[model samples]
Target: MKAAVKRVPVRNPANALTVLRLVLVPVFAVLTVMSEMTDSSLRIAACVVFGVASLTDFADGWIARTWGLVTAFGKVADPIADKALTGTALVLLSWFAVLPWWVTGLVLARELGVTLIRFWVLRHGVMAASRGGKIKTMLQIAAIAWYLWPFPAGLAGVGPWLMAAAVVVTAVTGLDYVFRALALRRSTRA
Candidate 1:
């Protein structure tokens, strides 16, 4: 006789919010591109949608932890939802020349590389987010938000500067994760 595998529920509030954020990615992307139109309303709408979607990220995490509804689905999907949102925003902004490609490249490289390393070391143990990682996330989100907003000419330099800080934090945190994963893999090998 074979035992059936038990599955974790993927329909929790946290996962639902995570999925909602994912769904909003394309909507956000389209709005961002449309914001390029002559109408200022599109730009404002884009930013508002982005801001609401960003809020869900924090809400999902908080609700999951506070309500004791955390699950493996939330763990995996939440980060992917975040990456999808940030990655698309970065890429789209770069496409429109609002952001420099180099900055987008740096952030994407770090994010993608760290994500790969996370899966590679999954068998060893689960890696927890460090304080630095949290800071990196916040900086990235703030920078992206600033970029999405249609600020005036006087404040043009702010987004790039924030992105520069985000890039630095992202790189540092990525390296930290790599080292942690390697150590975990080493310790588990014995």
Candidate 2:
């Protein structure tokens, strides 16, 4: 007897949201680069767009679960949108001297490292986002948002602390993922 296979379609609301996020990336980047015009108005505009784009990250997942519209495209596009938005923000922030080079480098390294691990694990099977990974994502968004905003003088200091916390969480979760991947590989080997 032949095994039955199920196919998941790509046109889903969640995937649409992911595409929206991807579109926002270049818009945000353009705004950030134009910061010099109108006394940093562009940066503020970029922050607003970036924040709205970030919110879609949560919304898309929620819609996917609520409506049962999850698809492989959503799975892939969502994370790519997240990394592009956050990575672009980090690069822009570093360029503007809002964040140190080392800080951005470490954060970018963690993101890239985890993505590679995910791909490696995918060769065997799928791995969902862990609780720690979610927390790290939240922390990263908060830190980037705070850094972008130009209000509340004292709140400016919060960005660095949030970034630091994010780094710690990112490192721990990344290591956990690597270990899990290794274990999965071993079990498959066995």
Candidate 3:
């Protein structure tokens, strides 16, 4: 007789961190809006919230993989939570005129396209995150934090440079994903 497989619970600690990240999104947004691009204390608060949320993004995946608590719910919810947090921050930054609208638009477009590609190739194969894609995510997080923080005027210039690098990496990684997804789908058909 075959032994039954033991299932990992959906309510595991890794998933809890993902949920926490999702919950922090709106709080971050609220604090950012209240800061109005000049209030240092509120901006600092918002920055702290953003940092904590970003850390959860890192921690959740680590905990899930390390502890063998990966679940179907985690597979779906984790990316959704990540995108929501990122998209919200980009939008807020653009709204405050701290970052260009085009920057947000391009990054978000690439992100949305990548997400669709994932769904498109889901039946064929899982498209793991590429090194370039991982770098793009880290660059984006760093750029966003740099912009969110109430840095001194001299240091303020660094955020734009970081964001420019992020945009280039984002576009490059997006094209790579598209090509890989097409290949994945084609190979599965053979």
Q: Which one wins on TM-score?
A: 3
lDDT of 3 by residue, 25-79 (tens): 9999999999997999999999999999999998999999999999999999999
Residue 26, model 2: lDDT of: 95
Q: Give a tens-digit lDDT track for model 2, residues 1-190.
A: 9897655568877888889899999999888878742345666898899999999999999999898787877878898999999999899888888788988898889889888988887878777789999999999999888787775668678888999999899889989888888988888888
Worst 10 residues of 1 by lDDT: 35-44
Candidate 1 vs. true structure, TM-score? 0.90
Output the worst ten-in-a-row residue range by lDDT, candidate 2: 35-44
Give the alpha-carbon lDDT of every model: 0.86, 0.85, 0.95
Error of 1 at 18 (Å): 0.6
Candidate 2 ranges with C-alpha deviation above 4 Å: 1-9, 36-40
**Predicted structure 1: lDDT:** 0.86
Overall local distance difference test of candidate 3? 0.95
Q: Which TM-score value belongs to model 2? A: 0.89
Candidate 1 residue lDDT tens string, 1-190 = 9998655466888889999999999998899887773346776787777778888998999998888788888998899999999899889888888888998898899888988998899889988888998899889888888877767866856988998899899989999999999999999997
